[model samples]
Target: MTVSLDELMAALTRELKPEQFKDYCPNGLQVQGRAHIGRLVTGVTACQALIDAAIEQKADAILVHHGYFWRGEDAVLTGIKRRRIKTLMEHDVSLIAYHLPLDAHPELGNNVQLAKILGLNPGSALSRQNNHDMGLVAQLPAPMSGADFAALLAARLQREPLHIAGSEAPIRTVAWCTGAAQGYIEQAVAAGADAYISGEISEPTVHSAREHGIHYFAAGHHATERYGVQALGQLLAQRFDLQHQFIDIDNPV
Candidate 1:
């Protein structure tokens, strides 16, 4: 069973509501590719390599976390940007991206998936900025030592997490936002989280963690966010009966 690009975009827009967000890039159908999609590829970023892989697979569409036409990016398509768009257009492969909507979705969101993986019983949004909270605040099923918690995160995310143990106290309340959201530590603290976890960290994050008495974990940004898009791809694959593959591009930062 094949789904047209227009049909897929309509379903996704209805589910994600890209219009509701003030994102860095255009949310849906950044590049018009094939008219009909029989195979889909999903990834964290729409990099050149991923595009090439999709081309190799003869993918009808590429779905990703990062796409083009970002707020701060150069609008004119040239250089690497032009090349990426040209490749997709030449192959008639559609590019559909979801940014914040992917992050904030209750069931299929990055934060929610991360919380589930970390064994946290999510309660509410850690911050109240967007319509829904950007991150999740959850209660740990049982208290665990900071070291043990770090070990758990490392095991689940498959990256050595940067752990800043603030106090000797165990962690029972946790908050997390995926993908380089170190700035949200304060918000997590405000949410009364004993610990905060995100993908990347700054030097000052150590000082903030120690002073605030909140354990901080810098899990890999690429690692923490891999689940949401994969889940979304699976759903789309099942719903549309399209072949789907999740291509992972390793990023140290």
Candidate 2:
């Protein structure tokens, strides 16, 4: 079954509510591709490689976590940006992106999906600013050693996480956010979390973890975030009965 790009965008915007967000990049249709979409491709970032793969698949629409026209970025499209837009326009493939909305969704969100995959039960938002913030406060089924918790994250994310054990206190409550959000560590502590998890680590983060008596884990950003957009794509695929494919372009960072 095929759906028009306008209809799909309207449905998605209504569901995701991209207009309500102050996101890093444009949340929908960064590049206008085809008018009628029969096949869809989903990925983490709208890089050249992912776009190429979508083109190869003959995808009419490409959905991703990161898209163009970021808040602070140059408005002028040139060089790599120019090429990327050119490719999408030439192929007539529509580009739709979701950032914080995808991360904050209860069922199809990145943080929720990460918790489910790692066997943690999410409780509430760690940050009060946005109930839909990517960071979440969760509780473990039972207390686990910091080492064991780190190992569990490693097993699921397929990367050796950087663990900074705070107090020898057993870990039961935790706060987590996917991608580079080390700044949220304090929010985790304020939320009464015994530990915090994010995608990247900074030098001060280690000290902050130790001083704050909260364990900190740095799982690979890309690894921790691969699930949400894929899940969203699957849902869209099933809803519209369109052919959908998820393209994984590995990023170590």
Candidate 3:
């Protein structure tokens, strides 16, 4: 079965509800390509490597959490950006992206998927943007030391997180926001979480965590966000009977 590009876009719009949150980039169909998509590719970012791979796989459309045209970026396409867009156009592959919507989706979001991976039970939403929750507070099955929790994150994410311990006590409650959400640390502290996890850590995060007696973990931004797009891809495949693939391009940061 194949879905029209418009149909796919409408489905994504309905599922992600992109209009609810003010996003850094446009939420859906950043680039137009084939009208009927039978094969779809999803990735964390719409980088040149992922686009190349999708083209190699003969994908009809590419769906990603990160896409071009971020707000305030130079409107003119040049260098890497130009190359990426040109490649997609050459291949006749549609490009679709959902930034905040993908991150905060109730069931298929990056936060929910990461929690499922680490066995964390989600509690309440946090960090509201445009009246929509952008982050989540969660509970571990049982209390564990900050070090133990860090180890669990490393084991699951396959990357050692930078651990800044603010308390010596075991972590029972945790708060998390994926991909460069270290700014939400204050909200986590206010939520009375024992530990906080985010993709990137700013210089001020250390002081905030220590002052508030809450642990902080700098999980890799790329590492933490590799799930949502895949989940969305799988759903699309199952829904439309399209051939879907998720290609992960490595990024240390």
Candidate 4:
């Protein structure tokens, strides 16, 4: 009913293979807590809200997709950052996170999970970086209008994606990258995807999609990434026979 923090960290690192990817933040065990964990909480971000929710759930370790210590972020821990880390340390809760590794995972990645939810069968990788695919191209069972595809995403993700319908043609191929990967649309276009889906969209994305005639969907970053951490937590909970809870802290962006 309990697993050591080190042991859990090792297992996660082994499964995710963080060493294989170039990530912004450190992965696997950001903060040290009690030696053993009996309750685990997983979420999209390690914000104060998630930490508070984890404490309410009496979690021993908090696992997340977005952790602290980015590449160009201010090195000093202050304000919100200071408070978040303090809360975890005060409560003796460990913080474990996986970033690029979680996104690039073949079976349990965020893109794959989103594809599964939308009933899209993956056909090929869209962007290959560091010897791993960052996004995936999926084959729809049948071609559908861009509007229809956007509606399907809204229904499945429980959030209306900002759809930029580029072409009137029915879409049979879509490429998806979760969490602020709208920049990968070029790769999707290169792959001849009828539509491209990602968490966020930029001004350039609008022009690219319109000019290239590829549908673009800007789903919420938090909403699109909610599944991967939960899936990983569920697997670990089942494997270690520990209590696992996935807490969602709503974020509009």
Clashing pairs in 4: none
On TM-score, the leading prediction is: 4
Candidate 4 root-mean-square deviation in Å:
0.7
lDDT of 3 by residue, 1-253 (tens): 8999999899988999988888788889899998999999999989899999999999999999889999999999899999999999988999999999889888999999999898888889978877777889987788999989999999999999999999999998999999999999989988889999999988999998898899999999999999999999999999999999899999877
lDDT of 2: 0.88
Worst 10 residues of 1 by lDDT: 124-133
**TM-scores vs. true structure, each candidate:** 0.96, 0.95, 0.97, 0.98
Per-residue alpha-carbon lDDT of model 1 for 1-253, expressed as tens digits? 8998899999999888888888777788888886889999999999999999989988999999988887876678889998998999899888999999999888999998898787778888887545777998888888989999999998888888989998789998999999979999999998999999999999999999999999999998888999899999999999999999999988876
lDDT of each: 0.90, 0.88, 0.91, 0.91
**Candidate 4 residue-wise lDDT, 65-172, digit = tens:** 999998999989899999999999999999999999889888888988888888888988998888998899988888899888888989999999999988888998
Worst 10 residues of 3 by lDDT: 126-135
Candidate 2 regions exceeding 4 Å error are 130-133
* Candidate 3 colliding pairs: none
Model 4 residue runs over 4 Å out of place are none
Residue 47 deviation, candidate 2, in Å?
0.8
